[model samples]
Target: MARWEPHARQRLADAALELFAERGYEETTVLDIARRAGLAKSTFFRHFQDKRGVLFAEDAPAGPLVAAIAAAPAQAGPLDAVEYGLDALGRDVFTADRRPFTLRRRAVIEAHPDLREREALKEAGLTAAMGRAIAGRGVPGLAARVTAELGGLALKAAYERWSDPAGTEDFGDIARQTLDEIRSAVAEVRG
Candidate 1:
C-alpha cells in the first residue's frame, strides 16, 4: 500500500496496537510497527514520531475541537459550549476504534510516572484551550476556567464509566450524571 494512502495512519495505528500488545509497549519499536503494517519506517515516522506517539494517537482534530467550541451558538452558556467540545472528544478521541489499545496504553502510561505527569499536563492544556474557547464565546475568566474544568471532569467521569464492563450507561448519560453531581456538590458547599 502507498505510504500516503488515506487509510495509512489507521493502518499504522492498528499495527502499533498489535505490536504494543504482543511485545509490550516498551519492547515495541517504531520500525516493528511499520514493518507489522507492511510499510517502511518512513511511513511510520510520517504517521507518528515513535511508539509512544500511538498513545496520543490524535493526528488531527485539535484545531477543530477548539474551533467548534469557539464557534458554538453565541447564546449558549460557557459550560454548554464546553460540553459540546467534550462530547466531540468523547465521540472522536475515546471511541471504540481506539479503546482496543486502552489496557496496554494506559498500563504503559501508568507505569511511567513521567508519562502520567505528562498526561496531567496534557489535561491542563486541554482545559486551558477549552477555557480560551469559552472565553472567545464571550464568557469571562474564572467562569470560563470553572466551566472548562467541569467539562473536563465530566469527560473524565464519562470515560471512567465507559471503561467499565458493567457500564451499561451511555456516554451522554454518564456525562449528565457526573455534571449533575458537580452541581449538587457545589450547591451543598455553598449552603
Candidate 2:
C-alpha cells in the first residue's frame, strides 16, 4: 500500500514543482508527479488531495511565516518580527537544497497570470494574519499592517533575487541587506 509519510510528501512536492516547471501547471498531472517521485499514484493521493495541493503544501516555509512571527520576542517590534519570520525561511526550503528547483517553481509561476494572482492572494493572507498578530502584541493596526505589507514586499524582492540564476548572494543575506535598505529608507523619510 502507498504511504503518506513526510518523505513521500516531500517527494510529491519535489516532483510537482519540477514537473510544473518543465511541463507547465495545466499540462502536468498528479500521475506525472507520482511517476517522477518514484512513488505510486495512490501514494500521491495519500499525501496531497489534488494537483494544486502540491503547490500549496502545508509544509512549505511560506506556511510557517505567521507562526514564526507570532512566536518572536514580544519586545521585538512588529517590523523586526516580520523580518525575523521571513528570514527564518531562507536556509530551510526556499533557499536550501531545493534552491534551483525553487527558482524553477518561481519561473513557472511568473509565466502564469492566474498563478501569479494566486500567489499574491496567498501573500496577502499571510500579511493580514501577521498584521493581526502584531496588533495583538500592542502594535497599532495601521503600523502592524504597514509592517506586514513591508515584509511581503521584502519577500517579493528577495524571491526575485533568489530566482535569478546569475544572482550569487545567499537568500538570507539578500533579505538582510534588503531589510537594511528598507530601514535606512524609513529613517530617511522620518528625518
Candidate 3:
C-alpha cells in the first residue's frame, strides 16, 4: 500500500468529486476514492471521516472569516466587518484557481438530496458562526445575527455568479456587489 503523501486531502477530494460526477454520489465508495487518488484507504480516513466528509472537508470557513471580522477597523459596522471577512475568504479560500473545483463541487452537491441537506446544514453552521463573530465585535446580538444572515445570502448569491462559466470577476468583488444589492432591496422593502 502506498503511504500517505503530501496533498493527500486535496487529492482525495478531487478524486471523490471526479468519481461522484462519473459514477453518481450514491454509487461511489470511499475505497474507490482512495484508489483513484493513488493513496491508501487509511489516508482517506485520516483526511475525512467517510464518503460524505470528502465533499465537506473544506467547509470549515469560520477561522479565517472570524479572524478577519475581528481584525477589521474598530469603527467598522457589522456589515462592513462581514465584507472584510468575506474578502478574506476570497483571498484565502476562494481564489481564482479554486473556481473550477468549486463549480464542480457545487454541481455535485446540487444533484443529490443528501448532499444538498448537508450543504444546508453547513450554511446554517457558517451563518451562526459569523453571527457569533460579529457579536463578539460589540455589535448588538440581533443586529449581528441579521448581518450574518445577510452576509450568508450575499455569499450564496455571489458564489452563484462567480461560478458561472463566463464569470471573470473576483469573489470579493461579486460578494461586495451582492451584499450591496441586498442592502438596497432591504431598504426598498422597508420604505
Q: 1-191 in candidate 2: lDDT tens per residue?
A: 44435589877888888888777899999889989988998888977889877665644555567667778887897778877777777756565566766676677778889878988887777667777767767888688878877887877778787768888777888887887788888788885
Worst 10 residues of 3 by lDDT: 1-10
TM-scores, all models, native as reference: 0.80, 0.81, 0.93
Q: Where is the poorest 10-residue window by lDDT in model 1?
A: 56-65
Q: Please write out the lDDT profile of model 1 over residues 1-191, one tens digit for every residue.
A: 56356677877888887776676777888778878888888877887876767777553435656976877788877767766665676566656655555545666677677678877777777777777888788877888888888876776667676666555555656666777787788788876
**Residue pairs that clash (backbone atoms under 3 angstroms), model 3:** none
Candidate 2 — which pairs collide?
A: none
lDDT of each: 0.71, 0.76, 0.88
User: Candidate 2: minimum summed lDDT over ten consecutive residues — where?
Assistant: 55-64
Candidate 1 local Cα displacement, residue 122, angstroms = 1.4
Give Cα distance to truth, residue 59, candidate 2, Å.
3.5
